[model samples]
Structure formats: structure tokens, C-alpha cells
Target: MKHLNTFNNTILYDFMELFHSLPYTFLGMEKSKDAFESAKVVLLPVPYDGTQYPYKGAANGARAIIEASRHIETFDDELNLELEDLGIYTLDELEISLESALETIKRVQEAVEEILDNKKMPIILGGEHSISLGAVRAINAKMENVSVLQLDAHADLRNEFKGCKYAHTCVMRRINEISHYVGVGIRSMSKEEKEFIEENELDIYGTNFNSNEILEKLKDKVYITIDLDVFDPSIIPSVGNPEPQGLFWIEILELLKKIAQEKEIIGFDIVELSPNSNKISDIYAAKLICKILSFSFFSKF
Candidate 1:
């Protein structure tokens, strides 16, 4: 019995080694021929988190999500499509800038601009929410009448936080300067953000917001920024901030499906996943990215 157990363990080890030896792309898929030229979607992993806060591991979130994605099945039963055929190209992780958050954001903006120039949809995997401003900046510069759809627990409307104007907490404020934005799944914010929302009559919605109302506020072109904390801690507890009573899986998916069916998603980012002992959170984040892509590209309903 002991020898049999040893053999089983050896086979398992060999299987894992073979799997790891494959090309390290999202979903462990083979590299596409002329990936950059033929691909309709380009994924940019931005591993950066410069926020001065206790939750410091978000810098590793992008890699974690990619690793978790390898275990997911490539076929989506709901969409009835194989994602691998979509020519989704995963670019090398962006070189992070240590100078400052603003500098990092600038680097992100440049990378996203290049992706846009290629005429492919950009899906940014975030190290933190602040990285989203870079993509938003790039999209706003090229597209007109663009509206940002923010899905997060916090309003992130602060002008500045911890002396950093470009910190993750203040990302939406900076975005407001470039294009109109609607905030949804928001359950927390500062008095300043509340006052600002009221003053501007911004389309900021709580957890119970109607999807139709949120869609009406958006223009034809929409850039979505999803902070993982917008999900209930019960579903995804590994984030920089875990607020209570957040949106559940099916609820958020329904809303995303509606948005994908209606709005023209110019670009999107998923951020603020600080990986921890709970491996489920990492897998959940990866699946969320896949579902979003599937909805945007292949959803019939």
C-alpha cells in the first residue's frame, strides 16, 4: 500500500510538471500565430500598488489571477463559445514605475495607447485600482463621449489620499477630469466624496441600483473599472478593502451581461485583488475576468 501511494504521488508530480512546462499564458493556451496582428483582444497585466496602506500585497495580484486562470476550462457553457478561438493575446507584464503613482499611471496610459493603436480591445489586469486611470486617460484621449463605469465598494471620489493625488482612493476624481463616469456597487465613501457626488449630481449608485438607470447614464462608449472589493467578502475576501453587503456573483454577472449587450465597451480593468491564504478569491477573480470577456465578445443574450 505504501508503494502504491508513492507511485500515485510520483504520477501527480509528473503531471503538474508537464502542465507548468506549457506556455504561460492566460488559461495555459498555446500562443496564437501572429498573436499581436490577428488577436482581437490584448491583455496587459499591470502589477503595481503604490498605495500607502496596510494591504500591500496587491502588487502580486495580477500574477496570481493569471496563475489561477490556467485551471479554468476554456469553454463557456452559457455563451456556448470557446475563448481560446477568440485570439486573446496576453502581453508581458508592464514594467512598473517606482517613481510615483502618477508616473506609474503615465506608463499604463502609454501601454494602453499602443494597444489601442493596434485596434484591439484592451483588458487590463490590475495591481491596484489606481492603474485604471492610465487606461482611462488613454481611451478618453482617443475616443469622444466616453463614460467610465466604476464598479467598486468605495466611491474613490477623493481629490487626494495620503498626500497622493493619484492614489487608488482618488482614482475616480482624476477620471472625472477626463470623461463622465457612473459609480455602482458603492457602499463606502468619505464625507468629501458624498458631498462631491451630490454637488455634481453624479450617477453614483449603491448596491441596490437599477441596471437600466446605470446604463442610461452611460454614453455609447464605456470604459469599465472593476475593483474586486465590490464583490461580497463572502465571495471574494482577498482584496485591499472588503466591505460588507456587496454584490453577489450572479447579480454582478447579470448587470455585466446587460452592459455588454447594450454599451460599446472600449476597454476595461479589474483591480485591487490582494491575494491571501484564501485561494478561492484568486480563482474567483480569474473567473470573473473570463466571464467578462465572454460576455463582451460572445454573449447572445
Candidate 2:
């Protein structure tokens, strides 16, 4: 058994060398193909799930999304463009200890601030919805009047949940404190959140609401935060919380395309994918990320 293990390691080493001489990045991109210094887009993996509830494994979301991206075709059919030339850099995953959610937010904020400082568009892959808080906070510091467009099953408007102000359940509430946002696919939330949304007269579109109407409310510069559970559970069941009668694949793409054409998507994050043994949801998440990136690339040039 020991000899067989050694042989396997040797073969793996040889294969890696033959395939890639540099560190791993999204889409299995070698260092030369997507150097950080020249890349227009950056993929930042935040694999921290300190505030998740009802499901655990969301901390592995970034790893699954990156692995699944390896299979994405470089050519985008919808836009009739090849996005590979744009230089997509996948930074090493953020080093996170199992700390309090506040500490995690600080770490993510610092990393995102650096990415913004470099003048690159940051695409964050999340461990949970709470991670978006840090990215949003960082972006808000740099860009004025930043509005968040949230795609999720829940409003996530709790001031605090499970005694943690930075809990995944309260992410949007924290975000709202800093910047204005519009919520879509919000079919689930507590009474308090519902009241909060109503009291504030927030611009939120329900699951059955028109997707196109979101365009009118969004600001010139928008940051998109997608929680995978916004999709019907039949298609993306491996999320932190699954809600039925959610948005479909095509509808989401159409909305994103429209937004890309009209609004400047400064940064975005896809979070809350609690991947199971099945690769189905992971692949879906990766494809969604790729589509958004493609649309974003087209918007720029």
C-alpha cells in the first residue's frame, strides 16, 4: 500500500508539471495566462462560514466553484465573445482562521480593499452570504453611492441573528446600514425583516416580481451579490437554505445582461453554495459566475 501511494504521488507530480508549472488559478489557468498584475478581473475566494446556520460545508464553496470553473469553455455563446483574452486572475484563497464573524469581515475587507486599490474588478466566491458584507464595505469606501443588487431567496435584513450581528442572516441589514440596495428573489424572511422592508419602503422584488423592473431602481454603479438559493431548489438545492418558486437560469442571465449593459458592475460575489457530493450545483454556480464575467467583460469593451 505504501509503495502504491508513493507511485500515485509520483504520477500526480509528473502530471501537474506537464500541465502547469505555476500555481493553480480558476479555470486551471497558468500564471502566464492570467498574471495578477495584468488581469482586469480578479477572483477572490473567501472560504469562511463562521456564521452559517442549518447547513455547514459552505466554507468549501470557493474550492468547489474554482474546480468546476475548470470545465467552462472559454468561448461565450450568448455574447459571441471569447473572454479568455481579458486576463482573469484567481488569487490564492483568503487565509481564514475559525474566528468571530467580525474578525472574518475585517480580513475580507482588507483583502478586497487591496484588490480595489489595484484598480481591478473583484469577483468574490463566498463561503456564505456574510462574506459579501466585507466586500461591499470595502467597495463602499472607494465608490460613492454604491448600491447593492442582491439576488437571494431571503431579504437577510435581520439586525442580528443567533446573537451575532454579522451572522449570515443579517448580512443585508449590515449592508443596508452602509449603502442602499435592491433585493430580488426575496421569497423568504422573518416578520421583523418584512416589516423593516415595508417600513423603509425598500425596493425589493419578490419571487414573482418582474426582473426587468429592477433596472429602473438600480443606480449607475452597482455591486451584485448572488446567493445561489435564489434559484429553485430543484436546480440549486445545495445551498444554505433552499426556497421554492425561485428564479430560473435564463431569466437570471437576461437580467444580468441588461444590468451589464446599463450599469457599471464594480464588483460582485456569489455565495451560500453548500456543496454536497454531487457536482451539479457546483457546476451551475461556476457557469453562473462565468456568464456574469462574460457580460461584465463585454460591458467594459
CA lDDT, every model vs. true structure: 0.88, 0.87
Whole-model lDDT, candidate 1? 0.88
What would the per-residue lDDT of candidate 1 be over residues 1-301, giving only the tens digit for each residue? Answer: 9999999999999988887664678787667668667878888998998783777888888889888998889899988988888877888899988878988999999999999999989999989999999999899777898889999999998998878999999999999888899999999998889999999998899999889998898998889999999999999999998999999999999998899899888789999989988999999988988888898888432
| Candidate 2 lDDT by residue in tens digits, 14-96 | 99889864345677665663377788888999898988887788999999988887877878887887767777888888987
The C-alpha stretches of model 2 lying farther than 4 A from their native spots are 1-23, 32-34
Q: How many collisions between residues are there in candidate 2?
A: 0
Model 2: ten consecutive residues of lowest lDDT: 21-30
List ranges where model 1 is wrong by over 4 Å: 1-20, 299-301
